[model samples]
Target: MSGPFDGLKVLELGRFIAVPVCGQLLAEGGADVIKVEDLDGDQTRHNGPIMPFEGRQYFNKNRGKRSISVRITEPEVLAAIQKLAAAADIVLANFRPGMSESLGLDYESVRAMNPRVIYGENTAYGLEGPMAPLAGMDMALQALTGLAHMTETGPEPLVNPIIDYAAAMLMAWGVSTALYHRERTGHGQRLNVALMHAAMFLENNQLTHVELLDSWRGEFVRYLKHAFADGKTWADVIEHRETLLPHKVVRAYYGFHATKDGTVGVACNARTQRLKLMSLLGIDDRWTSEPGWMPEDAHAHADYVYRQVATAFAQQPTAHWIAALEERGLPIAPVRHSDQLFFDEQVKANNFLAEVEHEVLGPIKVVAPPLRMTETPLAPRPPVSLGKNTREILAEAGLGAGQIDGLFARGAVREVHETLEDLL
Candidate 1:
């Protein structure tokens, strides 16, 4: 089937998560994505929890893209990449500061050859910042952005690298927006995405609360004091039973009681939903409407309600509770593991998973694009191996075989087996 971005060509000069993931998204949307790797290939090609024989991490983010291994520093390779950029509608890279310029792959240089190129860059910090030169990753950004501090349940903070994945998704959205703008204006622009900015944006809710609420600090102090005064650890204080907030108290209460065989994630964010949940559990009382219930103890009261609902839920298995909750129009779902997610009835019904036949790995499963468009649908394609299309991409860039072979002999271009058996 014809895809939305069928004619668009993208040259991806990136490694690891952010930029490559953006390229993958564009590729899923039907752009011809050419992943330009170094002579040794992208580092992520070696990152794994391998899937028996293939590089899982590489396959995961690189689906539907062709690979071109080239050392950007070499004149021939640089010339080849410049040609590719000239032919591309978009160019993406994630090199650190000064690296792209040193390799002659910076936006200005490429724009000189292709003025319509939508040059996108993903970096640890912004292009020009005090921390721009500092080595940054998702973990580092989380630490620097106060995400780790907020997520801390104990004395020491725990950082999750999944923040980078979220940042990558945001970056992809940014690039896609830029591409849309470029399509209308016919003026390609430089798009910059920094992990630090992405991390801060992701934590905007908490940051906004700190800025808006004058009493927020006091509330925090009170919470901490309560934690200590009650002789409870941070986890104890944060737990549903002790949250002292209506929603959390209720959520926690429902969380425990809503499970028999397995757990269920209950989302009762609205008053009507909460009411329905209460009615489903056969609870009707004046405690909800009573005034002077101690504003401070309001959360505690909610917790009591959750406890009652949970008791009802615990009486049945997860399936039974799900049916009952659905019948009452309550937002509830069973907790699903990663493997089980593939077979989820909803996922299968939506065709959220696509099967692609890999050259060496046979059949592989990939997630369909999360977006649903009536006119533009995403298609799945097999991921390319490291440098698998180097010569072909260069040739398409108008390079002759002699020039391509010279690059190969000059240690600027290389290719290897898809399985990495030769490198290993």
Candidate 2:
């Protein structure tokens, strides 16, 4: 099937994760995404945790998009970019405050050129906030939004940058909404996405913990200390341990009995499930009978189920446990590492990976867009090298050969590779 955005044109004047990821999603949806890079390319091009074929994080995030290496500070290059923007259906930028207007690529300028252009801006913070000018990265935003503190169980808090990825997803959703609105209204709109705001929104429930429960702060601290002391990591502590109080029943629920082999995670929060688990394990029902299980006892109950399941699972290999759980109609999944995800049978069955031939890297595997539309399946496209499509895109913009050469000579347009050495 053809893609949903077959005829749409998008000009992405963004860098790093959030905005570039949004553009990647649009490209996967079949938009003609032109990524505007500087002479040195996006900083993500140098980011590590590299794939076997992709240069760095950059190639992974930028697949299915063309690149235009232009020095936007230069008038000629800036003018050329503006011309491209004028012809684009969407313009995405993640610049600091005033940077877009200074470069003459803001929504106002693009709107003047094309009333139907949808402009999207992503920032570290909201445009009007006191911290508007503060630079934002996933780590910084995590700290600013209190996510770091909320997740922390130790004296010193820890932060994870996965929050940035979530923010990018949110930005993509917002942009898609704006595009849908434009389709109906026949007028474009400006969209703003801030990493800080996104992080806070993601922590909605945690933020309201104090407001919703009386004496929640003291209880929370005590829970935190106990969960941490129990040897759980921050994520584990916050989720399964600290969130619930410790009591006899709770201890029974959360406790895990280790067997000779692997471990299994089990939850028996519901009365029926707990009874079923107890019956299956041949455990005494008196555990639940004494002192009706209070809300604080939930943790203990979970621990009890966890221990039983762990012991049972330890008697068999992971595959055996999986089959046994399925046979019993129990909800269970073996934990998997990120690298193992690609090899998952379901992932392969769903065509979650796409193979592309690269000039330097030869055949490379890229993760396919996660969004699935039965009627309009996404098509994989190779990422362009720096300014690889400069001449072609400019030609589409109606620039003659002589004009193109003039711009090339003037450094208004750069080539992807000037020499074989560049391929390396």
CA lDDT, candidate 1, residue 119: 88
Q: Please list the residue runs of candidate 2 whose C-alpha ends up more than 4 Å from where it truly belongs after superposition.
A: 49-54, 146-161, 204-259, 263-274, 282-292, 295-317, 397-403, 410-412, 418-424
Tens-place lDDT per residue, model 1, 1-424, is 6777888999998888988888888898889999988777787777774532247788878889988887777777777777888878889998877888887789998888888888888888887868778768877776677677532365444434666677678877877787789879988889888888888787876565434434445565577656777777756645633343333324542343447788788887566676676666787534543423444565656667666766777778998878887887777888877889777888899888888987766787878777777878877788866778888888998889998888888788887665534324
TM-score of each: 0.83, 0.79
Error of 1 at 168 (Å): 3.1
Task: For residues 268-333, write the lDDT of model 2, one tens digit per residue.
Answer: 556666666666666654455454535445555556655665555567676665575566666556
Q: Which stretches of candidate 1 lie over 4 Å from their true place?
A: 49-54, 146-161, 210-212, 218-250, 253-258, 282-294, 418-424
Strongest candidate by lDDT: 1
Instruction: Give the TM-score comparing model 1 with the true structure, all chains together.
Output: 0.83
Clash count in backbone of candidate 2: 20
